[model samples]
Target: MAHQASNIPWNVLASNLHWSELKHPGHGDLHLRFKPDQGKKLHYFVEAFIRNIREHSYTARKQYPEHYNPPLPEEVILDDAVVCKITPTVRRWRAQRKHPGFCRCGSGILRSEETEHKCECPIPIPPEERTAAAFYRRYEPNRCYMFFETNGKAFYNLEIVKTLLLYGEMDTIFRVCAYPGVDLRTWWSMYQCYCENPDAGWDSLCRTALLPYIALNVISCFPETWDSASGKTNEKDYRRMRIYQYMLKHCTKSGMTTEVATHPHRQFFGIADGQFKRYGTEFRGPGLHIPYPYGLMPLEAFLNWDQVVESKPAPADIPQVQWILHSKGLPMELVLEIMAFAGYAPRGRLQVPHDPFHPENREELAKYLRFCWEVLVRCDMMAVALGMAIPWRDLVSNTLVQLLSCVPRRWYTIPDDVDHPESYVFL
Candidate 1:
């Protein structure tokens, strides 16, 4: 005998289902149920709910910018107090899930629903944890708690605000909470805190907030999707590259000379006038005369127009290498090493010294000597042994003496044109 195929229950078959209120109160009351069969199909439902809540909250805040207040108590400072309370609650909730009874047959069936309800519930500091001392401490005058009362309104969603506070770090909270359409006042407050405190971890937060937004505005000209030979590039990636290129072009146009961002000591010897003043043998005694140009020459040459133009991809085509090298503050030796590894030779020949006694020749040699000094300064002896594996000390010393004689005297002295009555002439 032929058998009929059994129909699957709609609720059981669907991945996600939502039930709304019943329309009628009688025996045959109508109910609205929405179910999504595929997981991806539920994306719209989730997105719509999130968007609706966000829009409603934003609109409400806008309607009454000054009067619309957060749900924080007047006595509590949202930043400190909320974080203290919410952190323990989240931890307890997590711990409860790990409890043996939480997953047993009776409670397990309803566990997920209960957990969801708990997440949506108002968070409070447990009575046991809230001692008289703690309360008194929280209410202490002229503390960070006072600012929380005035600033609590900046955080619109209580749940998100509570979650952020539970993280303990103020900068982390700001990053997760402050996105596009978030209140600028809240962002500004966090930004000021970062500026004042100057923590390294907050750098990621600052970059996310400032750079991407600026890039988006500038890259709106391009289509949302762009095809490349390898694959399609997303809008965000395309915008980032465009911003990088724009910055490179701007730096080039402005004639901004690249300096070692890390080693300011190296920069002290790069410019013609600055070089002689800092390291000239005439300015200091013989014992004070260090052989090297204090380690700055290679970086300076790499930054020069001649080297940048020569190292182009197509013999004349200016690539972004110059900008990259400059911005990263990578040393010339390292740059050359990278180029050699990549099968490219830096174009310019190291100009050979003709007359060793000539001032110009000595200057050129000094520049080379400075490069060696910089290498040593950047890496220790062991690192040099492991990496470069060369004897640099002898070479560095030899170059130093040759360059010292050429250090300009005028660089160390006051200008001849200056009319100072207090000036004393040294005969």
Candidate 2:
């Protein structure tokens, strides 16, 4: 077992886990396992967990009061053609039982095992979080990034995000990513329920389990918890983080305490304090969402979009930078146009992550942009960039800031109706 702090309720989770072997590329025959077996203890724990959170969130919603510039859609709309196709796939998946739960065979072996006998239980494969680290994507040195994905997680099997914290710099910070088991369209409809009633969150059963797990997972990674367990007031107004901090420290018996009266910023963090070399790929930039030209190409792409559309899959032996450019990458011209709009003159200083003026000011900026969007939409035409938008020059000195602030979040990347991971990537 990994060493854990005395205050942490590690056993709350440990009792639920069972181990299985995996094959890793760097280190062979490692272990990964599914979550709890169907037991009454887990049932009661999850119940009490949801009750505490529902009370807390209901109170917080009244006090904080979220500000949505534009409200959530009345409900998700699905096309009949897509409904015909996806309904069967979802049914087939459910019938086969493609969830992350652990189910044992009567033969005292696992169902996922490649044995000659195939008599097994409902679950086909376990969630991806516990899988042995194989096919690792290299991140840039000293940067913390998530690698493990607990995909296909839902109300039954809660999603857990795992970040692979690298040596030196990355040890000082952490980040987690999760793409839920619910498909895109289903997510919107279910998300609407959470919006309507905070007491019932985006599947409160999963969320109640998730909050305690985040603190447990982060603390377990850092070896010297006594010295390295650092914390701060979450000064930024990410509303989601506000609930996270409050629930972890006050509601859950995780042993974290907050001194201040204000609950928004009361959060804890752990920074690793040792030197370690874990196997992973070298850094590439974040896997970005790409736009296809399909007639809605941006004004900046000009002639290149036309030519690329004609003879795509451009190069034979493409370099790393150009690998998917012919297929999914935004044209080099579009990249330059935005940088030019931002006034990035001939390799001037670039914005670093955690630059206070950008993401940190997102809420205030969102409010200001909402005001701007309200003004523009009065005339009935809005800017046509229908997905993700990153603005560069706050510069009154720049040419475009005079005209536009941002592309609104509601200009959704609404697909023609299908289910795949990145279809709603823009949000």
Estimate TM-scores for all models.
0.19, 0.20
lDDT of 1 by residue, 39-116 (tens): 233333323322433343344333322322222222233445555645544432222322221112222121221122
For 1-106, candidate 2 gives per-residue lDDT tens digits of 2222233333443344322112212111111122345233333433343344334334433432232122122321222333343332222222222223322344
**TM-score of structure candidate 2:** 0.20
TM-score of 1: 0.19
lDDT per model vs. reference? 0.27, 0.24
Among residues 3 or more apart in sequence or in different chains, the pairs in candidate 1 whose N, CA or C atoms overlap within 3 Å are: 291-400, 295-374
List the lowest-lDDT window of 10 residues for candidate 2: 161-170
Clash count per candidate? 2, 6
